[model samples]
Target: MSIWSESTQSRAKEILAKYPEKRSAVMPLLYLAMAEDGWLTIEGMTEVAEWVGITPAQVQSVASFYTMYKREPTGKYLVSLCTSISCMLLGSDDVLHAIEDESGVPHGETDDEGVISVEHAECIGACGGAVACQVNYELIEGLTPEKGRELVRWLKKARPDAVNTDEMQELFGGRRSFDWAIQSDVGAAGPYPAFEPYGTATEDAK
Candidate 1:
């Protein structure tokens, strides 16, 4: 049986339409599958492969290489703490421990009800915001141990069906549509030639 729903399949068609080459749609399709299922199951990977005319192994290989794609089931909220040099100096370790203590789930694991999952991550590129953390891949900068605990509390009470805060709309909102990413600007915004022909400069020289 197909894991993809009818609506998801329709959205996949739209994403595929964006690229001239079908293979180029693989990443977006993979993200779509992850957003729909919360993790990339073998079935989902296979379906994506079929859509892009690639082998399942190829899809799996690509999926395995990216940290953004989760192989195991994750909670509704994924809390990732960055403990790189910059964040560690600012006490990211304490923040992680506080979350583990408050939620009773260690790193790489989820709570009993699967409300939240905590993990220590490498630099997430928020150096200025020391002790940076991510809830569902959205950076929550300048966090403390207390803040982490508060976040866990909020996530526990958060309803997926309820309206999410502006920062979290993407996660709670159903499957993502890439319609916003397609560029519509057609003006001559750059110095480079927009049309294809023999170079004007070369013709002038001749």
Candidate 2:
């Protein structure tokens, strides 16, 4: 089910040795594999389980528990707008709708052309940014419905190969791009910790 490369598989094997809780290594390994393959396949997670001396079930559970591990293919630009409470109160729902209108894609699914896909997440730890998101792994904050539309247009123009919009080329690219993270207490009060970075495969595990 995994689509990991030979190098990644070897690295996962090496990193697993240093962990007492094999589950602790699942996230980072999935991230590295996804980074290499652009998606995490069932086979890929299973391979990680094998390397880590754990069952495939354990890996699957860990992968499914976290939203950061992508189980499907993502677009050239990943627009992860925050639709959580703070963002919702700030009109993030409208922002999400505008993005959907522009891209013709929905949550948890990729577009037909795979240009830009949306993944809804709870507070990206930027309540101050309010309705902000991370695009292409780059954090973007200070979101508005108009600004969101402008972003969709800009990305379309920047990568014409990624979308079908001549109008995008006409839109302004440079200007006030929003800040990524804002100081906020929203993420801090969340049930889960936000600083949980995924594990990656290392040479020692192999």
Candidate 3:
């Protein structure tokens, strides 16, 4: 049996049709697999290999190269605190420590309940909003130690089905990277891109 569901299979076909070469579809297909399992599983990789006519090792190589692809199980909310120059200079370190203290887990580890995972990221491309972090890859800017702790506590307590980016920014973020004209309701569920609009199938099934 295939790992992909009926909808995912159809979506995969659509993605493959867009690319001239099947190999070019590897990245998007990998995202699809990650969305299915929350992280890249061996079976999912194997299926992707079959779809793209590549070896499983080759698929693994691609997945390992990108930090966005989670090789292991991650919490529902992946909190990636930026530790790059701009963020570090603006007190990202203190914010990171504060999150660790509140979540009771060090960087690169998940909480006891597996709801939140904390990690130090190099640069999330939000330097304008220094001291930034991404919750499930949704940017939350201008985080202070207090706001960092509050963010984790809120995730643990609420465990909302969807984590709205705009709402989070308004509540916990400050200093925008740029003026935003459009609004989005997309909620990220894990490290990888959520294939569906509202969220991944895993989130939608719930």
Give me the candidate number with maximum TM-score: 3
- List candidate 3 segments past 4 Å from native: 195-206
Off by over 4 Å in 2: 1-14, 17-23, 160-206
Candidate 1: lDDT over CA atoms?
A: 0.67
> On residues 1-206, what C-alpha lDDT tens digit does candidate 1 reach at each position?
45778777877888888899999888888877765676677888999999999999999999899887788887767778899999899888999999899888899998777667888989988777677776665556677787778777767775332212223323322222222233222211111111112010111110
Name the top lDDT candidate: 3
Better of 2 and 3 by lDDT: 3
Q: Please report, as a residue range, the 10-residue window in candidate 1 with the lowest summed lDDT.
A: 197-206
The C-alpha local distance difference test score for the whole of candidate 2 amounts to 0.61
Ten-residue segment with the worst summed lDDT in candidate 3?
A: 197-206
Could you tell me every candidate's TM-score relative to the true structure? 0.75, 0.69, 0.92
Ranked by lDDT, top first: 3, 1, 2
Give model 2's TM-score versus the native structure.
0.69
Between candidates 1 and 3, the lDDT winner: 3
